[model samples]
Target: MQFSIATPTAAEFAALYLETGWGQWPLETFERALAGSWVVCVARDDDNRLVGLGRLIGDGALHAFVTEMIVSESARGAGIGAEIVRRLVGEAHRRGVRDVQLFAARGRAAFYERNGFARRPDDAPGMEWAGESRGTAVP
Candidate 1:
């Protein structure tokens, strides 16, 4: 697998995002979001097909968080996800971002831990603004 990570063009990013079930946003919305992100990393296979993606968003200094990490179902378990995280963290470091963070889904904490992320007891709770009901609510 000849893979590479780079900042994807807006169109390429939107295309891969749709492939990963983020089709709710219109193309224009995707373009806007892509332009606003501090950094976006895409993983491509030997054939140059996009197999994974991740993005970082925050002010240019002091804070940043990795988000939207997704790998094509067929590409899972092949270290593509790890590569994306590695690249994203590298980008943050290069930018001199002071606080890089990511929220792992349940049961996936070990994966991030392996990548050098530690649980933070001093961090405040995080929240999300869901635009639509997903049959759940915060306590």
Candidate 2:
């Protein structure tokens, strides 16, 4: 497999996301998310098919958030996801970022923990607010 900083097509990203059992999102939504993201990494097989993808979004200064991490079902056990995370985090470090954050899906916390992420402190709880015009974009 090969990994590189990439801007993947909406179809490739949508296929990978579907592998996670998440509902299909529109191509435009995927494109819009990539347009606003700070960093992106994609893994391709020997055949040059996209098998993994992840992104980082933040101000690129003190804080960065890891998001949209997904590895195709056929490629999950090969450490592609971990490599993606490692590269993303390493890029954050290179940018002088101080905090890297992510909201891991249920049952996937162990993966992030193994990558050096810890649960939020007792004083800090994860929260969200969908605005009145909640967009369809993944966040």
Candidate 3:
């Protein structure tokens, strides 16, 4: 396995989403998101196939949020995901950003915890609003 800071092409990134059951987000949205991220990292197998991906998206100075973190199911037990998080966090710290945050998938909090993320306290909850609840949900 090899890790690279290079950003994956939109197709490769969307494929990662599908492989991880994260749904196939449209390529155009992905292109825009990728353009906006401050840092992106991809892991490739010895064969040069994209096996894992993670990225950081946020304002450059004060806060950073991590999302779209995924490691191929086949690659999960090898610490690739942690490495990706470490690299992203390292970069964020180097840039003097302290308010890094991420939402872990169900049952994955421990993974994030081990990677130096802590749960936000009940007093400080994370909330979301989905555009006034149109009959359909996009996420």
Per-candidate TM-scores read 0.76, 0.85, 0.85
Each prediction's number of clashing residue pairs: 0, 0, 0
**lDDT by residue (tens digit), candidate 1, 1-139:** 5444456666777777777776666777778877778888877777887788888898876667877787887788999888878777777666766467777776876777777676656455432221122223323
RMSD of each: 9.9, 8.8, 9.8
Q: Per-residue error at 37 for model 2, in Å?
A: 0.8
lDDT of 2 by residue, 25-55 (tens): 8899888988999999999999999999989
What TM-score should be assigned to candidate 3?
A: 0.85
Candidate 1, run of 10 with poorest lDDT: 127-136
- Candidate 1, residue 127: Cα displacement in angstroms equals 13
Consecutive 10-residue window with the lowest summed lDDT within model 3: 127-136
lDDT, model 2, position 105: 86
